[model samples]
Target chain A: MVKEQIKPMTSRERVLAGLRREPVDRTPVCNPTSVATVELMDLVDAHFPEANRNPEMMARLAATGYTEIGFDSIMPVFSIIQESSALGCKMQWEQKDNWPTVRMREPIWRDVEDVVIPNDFLTHPDTACVIECIKILKKEYGDDVAIIGKTMGPWTLGYHCFGVEPFLLMSLDDPGKTKLALERMKEATIQFGMAQIEAGADALTVPDHATGDLVSGEYYDRYLKDMHAEFVDLLPVPLILHICGRTVDRMNSIAETGIAAFHFDSKNKPQESMDIIEDRISLVGNINNPETLYAKGPDAVRDEVCANLDAGVHMVGPECAIPLQTAIENLTAIPNAVKEWHSRRESH
Target chain B: MADLQDISNEKIRQEIEEFVENPDEIERNIETFARVRPLMQEIAAALIEGDDGTVDALTKQALEDKIDALEIMDDGLIAAMGVVGIKFRDNYIFVPEVLACARAMKAGMAYIEPILSASGVEPLATVIMGMVKGDLHDIGKNLCIMMLRGSGFNVVDLGVDTSDDEFIDAVEEHSAPILGMSALLTTTMPNMGKTIEAFIDADMRDDVKIMVGGAPVTQEFADDMGADAYGKDALECVAVAKGFLSVQA
Candidate 1:
């Protein structure tokens, strides 16, 4: 145990440093998805819907997360709708600063046979903006700040293209159809993932909704188990898997995914989840974003962060993308908590 | 050994037949603290077989037989689900099977709810549930609704991406005693508190209890927001809601 003195580093260095398993001066506070706020929308003039898709505006607004809150990284893309938009789902582009949502009433694919990964999918503006944002961040910060990119998993793509109710029903009635859908969508996952890796993204977050509500751990094994393992093989950089809900059920399988880490939810106990992962991969978070970061103040954020830090996650962050209205002080408290934890550990 | 084995076999056969013919009776007995493990296995099979009509018929019989809904949830279905949930917790079962059981439970509930509603079973309390603004994640919110309903509360689900004004409107519309707010994203979680503040501004905070849950929430944070309760999962939400409603009584 060669303990060394720690110092402040840039967000890019802090994140990349952690990925490499090197000692970081302090924990990096970065979300691989947008932490866009309504305040940022007014500041950068890059509101949602477009901020979710446009490169320049997206970068400008995302930068606020880094500039204003002192997070180690900036994420441009706001929602998982991009992959579905490319996959041909009917989209409702809401107001500026609002993420576009897929209209489930109008599913693009009624059946698995209708699913296809378009050849020019990566070149789509929604996809291209992410790449452009990465480039903009790289050029602007020049290795000072980490640029996080995001891609949708095949399951999330399945939700957008096939619709939530339809997709769940297909999985129930015809397992074969569900497999077929996930398989065809795998190419989209790979294509977008590779493009982001090629761009200046320090890491990429793959958020799939393998929740306890809609599906079981068996579904993760039947579908996502191997697919996630394949993602570890395909992507060149560190990959983080973010799933919503009480995913303690799938923790063991998720630990086996061979990705760099798993970003978990607060519904999961930090100590219990830690015991499950057991150092198989770096753990990112289980912060109570709604109750702590969103509803409460910075002091509450600090309390939750210390709990996760004490539980031994590799990084500390909001459990997921933060609410648009979360106060800046609350977001900054994550890093502050990390720093306080480090100091406390040293004194002990 | 042979005599014990023969007796066990006879018991099992009789239990299986009863489970197949009278699942509702088994559920009702379970409410009275009678063990329904064998019957639960039978119901699980019926569910996996997708015998919707059989499940419906059995559910109706259970209501007729006076099976306590909450007891059925705890002793029969959720108990079976506990098996699935444990396997899921262990990675032995995956998303598909869990979803299947959830569907089966939902199917059973659909049959049971109308009966429970008609029985004029007064809810322990009325809870208005919703997701706050700038968030579309409802899976957690939906789970809490099921647990709240199962625990004997009448829940008014306002659905996802709800604004402060909408929550205020629901509180007035339903005249509910408790409010449960949920958000999956850190970004939307604070809106839960702001929504609470809105209630305060409208002078409606005194009349209602506020409970918050989701992937991003914490109890300490709930306290900071002046929320009455904080639930970690859907099951916990039921316990918390029950506690609050009981306190009021």
Candidate 2:
């Protein structure tokens, strides 16, 4: 294998190089979702539901990804609810230990016509929190660590605003109406996405839960592909598109969308995922969240990291969002494993 | 095997074909119906078709006509649900389809509950179920509850964010043989272990067998948490619940 003898890169340079699928000194560790842990919350004095709403707390907690754990990028938006909350959906911002969820059971919008991008969508405290968090991270760690921001995709926004059942039923019962809803909803994606970019995010992790089990490959082709491709033009930043669950079926369709990378889940095997995308876009993630990281020790965590690096995934990190109570040593094992694997290769 | 396409009642067959997507699963569903009485076949077909009103009406009329409620439940709702479970497990169908089937089964079970209770026809087992503390996700948990009920287990659902004491309290109150915990988020999964430790602390761990499941849960995690059983989906949850009953028996 031809290896680069380039000088060592900063975490920011490595991440941006990874996004561009360029050669870096080593593979950059980028978690397009989150890596927040309760232990980290205690260390940084940034706790959830509040960290999700407070820009400084959010930035402090997010910086632990780079500052404490040595991830190549610092992702400030830990939760998926910021856009949903700002859009007027009711929220269940649970205790400090739990994830703040949208009250999706009580959907805010029933029809496309009922949907409104309130003038305050961006400036609303929840939305502003994310923008402000990115700005703070950029100000503090701008030159050293990649500040990756997150924006919810229209499909996920559809689930929050219309509720999961009604939205899935809509997709099944009326394709035209679902398309209309997605088209109307895509604006929100571009809106928050551009807002974060303007706030100085090196790239964006747009989590659209068009997940594998609920939606199909054909569904991706029909509903999300063009919109994602359109996002490439609109967001004007390298997008690490994230969809959870076993998503091997849609990787081919996703590769055609012009996004920079696919932030995939552990449910997908790293080797099979790499083969599916055919290197059309950068691939990141595959470390298991629940079993390998949360439940097991660092050895198990290192094994998964090594597997993803071996599969030639461009960047590596937890597949979905970090489970909040996951142990600290398990989190650090991610970058530790990545560096070890590359070092062994260099020795050869 | 003669083709499932050979079955009469194109209405029921078409419904089965639409909702039961895999060819092998479609054949199995046809055989489940073909082997049962015509009335039971009608009920099973209605359940698969997710026509809760039809299941409700058919169940009510069958009981009025003196058809054994057990036959209607076993031959009808449970049999149909087995197919729904298979389709969902196999990824040939998804949440919407399974939910419709669950509601259809619930509609049928509504009639069976009173008859079984009044006749002293004991349920499969009383099972305590809940989402672990700090995890509000319940789509998978709700689906498992419906499946357990369809399979004749009387389940007491504690809803989401259930504290550890609540799980022990439910088990003791109901004298249940099985307890199932679910958590969709990885962060909240440790609560399953914490709840198990709570049972051990209360000195009631021996009273009820524990089973854990959810989206991110796996057999290895379940074992690590010291759970007696782990189910990947709602279908498997029923099997695990039954397995727990046999272990107690």
DockQ leader:
2
Residues B1-249, model 2: lDDT tens digits: 756665665655665666677676677767766677778878887887788999999999999999998889998889878877876887777787787787788899899978878889878889999999877678789889999888888899998889999999999999998999999887788899999999999999998899999988889889989999999888889988888767321
Candidate 1 C-alpha lDDT tens digits along A1-348: 113586667778888776555678777777765678777788779888778777888889888878887888777778778888877787877665355677765688888788888877988877888888888887897478877778889998888887776687688778887888898888888898888878777788999887765577777898898999998998888888988777888899998988887888788888899899877777777667656666678888888888887777777788877767677788888877887888888888
lDDT of 1 by residue, B1-249 (tens): 122123222333343334323455344333422345444445544544445455556655665777776555555454444333334444444444445556677777886677667878677778999887766666567656755664567889988778899999888998998899987655556677789999999999998988898765778778877899898766567767778766521
N/CA/C clash count, model 1: 29
Candidate 1 lDDT = 0.73
> What is the DockQ for all candidates, taken in turn?
0.26, 0.49
| Position B150, candidate 1: lDDT | 49
Give one digit per residue, the lDDT tens place, for model 2 in A1-348. Answer: 115687888999899989888888898997988978889999999897788899999999999998888999999888899989999999989877888988777899998787888899999999999999999999999999999999899999998999887787778768898899899888888899899999999999989988876777788998999999999998888999999998999999999999999999888999999998887899989888877777789999999998888889999998988888888889889899888998898888
> Per-prediction TM-score, please?
0.72, 0.91
- How far does residue B15 in candidate 1 sit from its true spot (Å)? 11
